[model samples]
Structures are given as structure tokens and as C-alpha cells.
Target: MSYDAKVFNVMVASPGDVLAERALFREVIHEWNAVNSEVRKVVLMPVGWETHSSPEMGAGPQEIINQQVLHSCDLLVGIFWTRAGTPTTEYASGTIEEIEKHIAAGRLAMLYFSTTPAVLDDVDNEQYQTLRDFKASCRSRGLFESFDSLAEFRNKFSRQLQQKLNAHEMFKLTQTESSSNQPVSDFMRLTVPSLTHEAKVLLKEVSQDPHGRLTYVRYIGGAAMQSNAKSFLDSKERREVAKWENALQLLQEEELIVERGHKGEFFEITAKGYEVADTIIS
Candidate 1:
């Protein structure tokens, strides 16, 4: 089946704290990709170093890897497992940094999978506290997803992911329809505190100029409202101009048109704009 290229990019970040949880994440990605042929590939970043080369690196290698992963991703998935003591080999500073960065960038759609805290007691005591802290942080950010077992985690993760994807697709469809059918008059009705309806209509017309800048002098005989306003001031005429201007603004905001001159006065729609317009109108 054909798919849209606008598939969301998800980033998985689970340091070694939960080794079993990795499989659940991988399965979700695999299922999502299989069903959504248009989605590129789901990328899974490594959580820990395969082999320790030097402590002197000070998490630099992991940091670099995390940066690369975060740069290309649109969402984050974090897995949490409770242990009595933090595992000395598991908590990589770089992994935490990646999560922080993702949150900062406003692209963090985090889901947490938590295991029993009792099972963690056999591990490092201090490390267990660290894990608790991590869980608390996830709770604060509203990123926590609790699971009693691996199977439970798998089921919940898949359900949540599907929900997110569906919501996004629905939103895109809504925007596409609105932008296509919206009349210019609807947009002209928006009141800019200082601008009159006539002035708003004039501004809307000038904003739609394919040349980017309004040549009112050329189009309106050197007066902003003298030409077009005189010819089209009837309610019907005003509505038509409003509809056209609304369409133009939508196209421009979507980057279908590039305004080049100072103050974006001059403009030309890109080839994509024409295609979109055709799709909408035809």
C-alpha cells in the first residue's frame, strides 16, 4: 500500500537499565514500518558502549552518537526498569543528555516502561536511587508509561504509538481540506486592531500579488483603493477578492510562495504551490 512521506520520526533512548525492554521497542518500530510503507525507516540508537575503550573519553563518544540521533528524530521513547542499586555499567551520562536535549527542543513525546522496584534491590543501592530519580523526572515531564511485564509494555507501547500516528494523519487531512476550501473573505474578516475592513481587504489583495510586492500604482491607478475597490466594492466582489487573498496567504505561510524583496513585498509561489493548488481545486 502507498504511504505518505510525512511519517513521524521516532527516536528510542533506553540506556542499559532495561535490557529486556529494547525488544518491545524494536517490535513496535517494526510493526509501524511494515504497516506504513511511506514511513522511512525507524532508527534505534545504541544505549551503551559495546566495549570500554577508555574512561578518559568521559562519555564523549556516546554524547556524539546521542547528538546525531536527536538531530534527526521527532520523538523520544524512554524505557525504565527498577533495580535496588544503579548498575555501574548502565547509566551513561550521554544517554541522559540526549533525553534532556529532546525535551528542550520541544519534540519530546516520551513514553516510559517501568518494572518492579523490588527486583532492583539486588543491584547497586545508589544506582537504585538513581533509577528512582529518573522515574520521578519522567513523571514530572508527563512521560511515564508503567508496565507490570514485558508483554504489557509491548501491548501499551504499540497502542500509544498507533494513537499518535492516527492523530497526526487526521490533523494533516483537516489542514489540507481547510486550506483548499477556505474563502478569502473569511480571512479578510479578521480584524487587525488598527486596520479598517477596506484597508484589510486592500492589504489582502496586495499580499496575494504573484510579484511579491503590491504594485497598487500599476494595478489600482496609483491609489490603494481607487481602482479595484471602485470596481469590486460590491459585497459579491469583495467576497471573491477575500477568498483569493485567503488562499494566497495560506500558500505563502506554507512556503509554497517565497517573498524575496525587502519586507517580503515581492513574491512567487514555488512549483509545489501550483501542484497543491491544482490538487485542491481540481
Candidate 2:
């Protein structure tokens, strides 16, 4: 019952208005996996905060959701309609924050803004304006598509998903060829990027947490991590703070840790991160 197929987690991020689009997204992803998984040797798993996260407290609610769900996504699909989504401290809405974070990681983020006309009374002028601004921002950031109906979105998504799979296959092939040509030592170096001492120290500190979570902003303060993180950090150079920040970003990119607080102020040790740190500590 064990098959070796590469699994890609696709995060579907959206606001309240796009209920139909969200449902269609799940259907499309299911179809993709069913049709393409066997032949392609890959499966696309759809992920979203609503399904992935349970109730938790500590940082802002949205931040916690991000840490749990957003960090693990291999690809992000953002859908927007009349609603721009509720405001957050950092971005106009949580969806925006999620999409931006995913894109900032130098990964793929596909945004679909609905252009279908709506009744004047049903639309919130302010919310629509915010959505417009975000759509414009998307144009500057990357290419985005629009659909007038759910049917259209479904068709477009299927084509796009196929293209993505094709690209993934090419990338794997390239990596395989490149690795084959490189020396063992060179391949090892290329595969494993060295983790900085500060990053290791921070990971070590978080690894000690009984609850397996840390307040993102508070961790910057000495008291949050107690003498453990502080002691190690204090022994380092004057740029320790910057090093810590860099470590967090690196851990994030490596999918070793997840952040949950607004403006990325909360973090927790992901299972993968914990395993790595456990090995190091042992």
C-alpha cells in the first residue's frame, strides 16, 4: 500500500466571497491528482487554513493560522471576488498577507481575481476598492489571471496545473542531470546549504520549548527565550540580532519552522525542524 509519488501541497487562499471558487478549486485539485498522479508520479494535495488549523491562542488569530498552514504550502492559489477580506496589522487582509508571504519566499503564487459584475447594493465600495488596489499590486508583482465565471476559472486552473506539473518534471530532470555531473563533494555542498551558528542556536532554543512554540516578537527580547537563547546570542558578534532575523528567514525557507503572529511575530517548531534539531542535540 506504499507508493513513492512526490506530493505537492497546494494552498488555496481566498476571502469569504469566493465560496464557489474555493469549492471548485478543491474539485480541480482532486481531478488533477486522480488523472495525473499515477502517470506523473506526483500528487497535489490541497491545503487551506480552515481545514489545517484548530483553535489556538498566543499571537493574532490569523498569524497562528499562517504558521500552521501557509508555511508548508508548495504552491499558493489566491482567489478574490468582491470582498478584499478583513484588515490585518500588516496587510489589508489575511489573504493578502498569506499570498505575499508565499511569493516572498521565491516560490509560485497564482492569483485569480474575479471580474464578474455584482449588484451595486451587494458590493462594499471600500472593500472593492481595496481589492482593486491589490489586483493592481499583483500586476506589478507578477502575472495574474481573471475569470468571469467559476466554469472559466476551472478550465484555466486545469491548464495551469498541467503546465506546472510539466515544469516540475523538467526541474527534477535538470537537477538529476546536474547532480550526476557534479562530484560527490560538490553535490553534497549543493544539496545542503550550511546553517549559520546563530540559526542553529535559535533552533536549539526553540527545540527546548515544552509546548513547541515561541512568540515571534517576544523571542527577540531576552526574557522570552530565557538565558538559553540569550546566553548563546550574547556570546555572538554585534550583528547578532540581524543574524537571528536571517536565521528565522532561512528556517522558514527550508520549511523547518512556521510563523503565526501578525507581521510574522509568532513561530513554532515544525515537525521537520524538531527532527533536525533533535538529531543535532543528540
Candidate 3:
């Protein structure tokens, strides 16, 4: 089967009221696009503009950009600088609505980054409170990522993106390693202990026959030793019979012993069984 390269669309949401946050968002998207060809699209919401030349465009330029940004992207990246004044109520409304739309469409993954209030001048007590509210909102919706600084954000974003991309490759490698053949000795070493414990339990049950040696084998056969009934020894044991029977079937299917026509069947261990038994005893 052929695989197609996947394209990632990123949308950045920032408190447009803060110049520093707007600048940072722009810089990050620009740098990300330059480095990762897979990230085919990047859209920034209202807080993205630096300065507007035309006042005639009307007062709702930010709202218009917010709507456009939401419509264009698949993933939303929220940059939270608590010190930056809370996004205007209008910005918050637009973001919340966009988030709902993305969720309904099953097309959204969200990441959040928070910056220290002390680092930005406009970030005040009221702004911090607004950020706390925003953080709480994100937590309730289970949409968040956190960073201590811009540098941290850069590092973490790259790491997360790489992990998302390489996950399938890693899984495929694990499957390949598991399927490659291994030596019988290696298989024996891994399987013997558990097999020995199981054999001991089965042998113990066989040894418990109240009849003579010939009748003992007969009892085992009558109990359908070839079936899963070996686990029916106790009150709660019936449920586990199928599991025991499956294990027993593996041993029988390997021809570990020959069954002579039902004159009280006798078990003469095969060469394979003798080798396995000797290994267990030693």
C-alpha cells in the first residue's frame, strides 16, 4: 500500500490587545512554516495585526480576522500571556464559537502556552485574573499546553510535532522486530518456565487418580484430557477450564506422546517430551 504525506494546518490565537503577544505569534508561525514543509498552512486570528493603515475599514477588523482564521485552520494554538490584557470580550466570543465549530467538525487540536506577567508591562492584576479565567475554561474543555517562556514554547512545539509524525514509524519498527525469526533455543528459554509450571499442575492432577495405573490413564481419557475440562477441579475452576484445555491442546498437537488404542491408554513420553522433561528436572 502507498502512503500519502499528511499536511498540518495551524491557527494561532493571541490576545490582540498585547503587542508583544501579537509579535511573538507572528514570529513563531513564520519560523515554523520556514522549517517544516509538512505544515502547509498557518492562520493568525485578530490579535495578529501590528498596525492598521486604514481607519475606514471599520472598527471590527479584529473580529473579521478572527472569523477568517477560525474558518481556515485545523488546529488551534492559544498563546496566553496573562499580563497582556484579557482578550477583548469580542475576541473571546469569537474564539469560543470557533472552538465549538472545530469540535463539531472533528477538526481541532489545541495547544496553549502561558507567559509570565512580570515580563510584560501591560500585564496587570486584572489581566492576570482574566488569564486565570481563560486557563480555567481551557481546563474544563481539556484543551491546553503550557510553556514557561518563548524559548520553552519553541522547543516543546517542535518535539510534540515530531512525536506526532514519527509515531507510526516507531510502531512499524516494533512490529518488524517481533515478526523476524528467532532460534528454537531462544524460544525454549523464554517458554520453558511457564510451560514447566503448567506441566507440573497437569501431572499433579493426573497423579491424583484413585484407580490403578491402567485405570488412571482411562480416567484421564474419560475426563476428556484432550478437552478443556482439566480445570474443573474446584468450584470456581470451571470458568478456567477452557484456558487449561487450550494449553493442553498445544502439547497434544505437538505429539508429545502416543495414545495406544483405548486399552486404558498409556503415556510413553516421546523423545521431544523426554528432552523437555529432562531440561525441567535439571
TM-score of each candidate structure, all chains considered together? 0.48, 0.60, 0.41
What tens digits encode model 1's per-residue C-alpha lDDT throughout 100-143?
67777777566575755544445666655666776667766674
Per-residue C-alpha lDDT of model 3 across residues 90-116, encoded as one tens digit per residue: 534344444556666776455555654
Local lDDT at 269 for model 3: 30
Once all C-alphas are superposed, what RMSD does model 3 give against the true structure?
23.0
Q: Model 1 residue 219 lDDT?
A: 40
The 10-residue segment of model 1 with minimum total lDDT is 221-230
Ranked candidates, highest lDDT first: 2, 1, 3
Candidate 1: segments with Cα more than 4 A from true spot: 1-4, 38-59, 83-92, 117-121, 168-282
Q: How big is the positional error of residue 130 in model 2, measured in Å on the Cα after superposition?
A: 0.6
Task: Give the number of the best model, judged by TM-score.
Answer: 2
The stretch of ten residues in a row with the least summed lDDT in candidate 3 is 209-218
Global lDDT of model 1: 0.49
Q: Candidate 1, 139: how far from true, in Å?
A: 2.8
User: What local distance difference test score does each model get?
Assistant: 0.49, 0.72, 0.44
Q: How many angstroms is residue 63 displaced in model 1 relative to the true structure, after the best TM-score fit?
A: 2.5
Q: Which one wins on lDDT?
A: 2
Clashes of each: 19, 2, 3
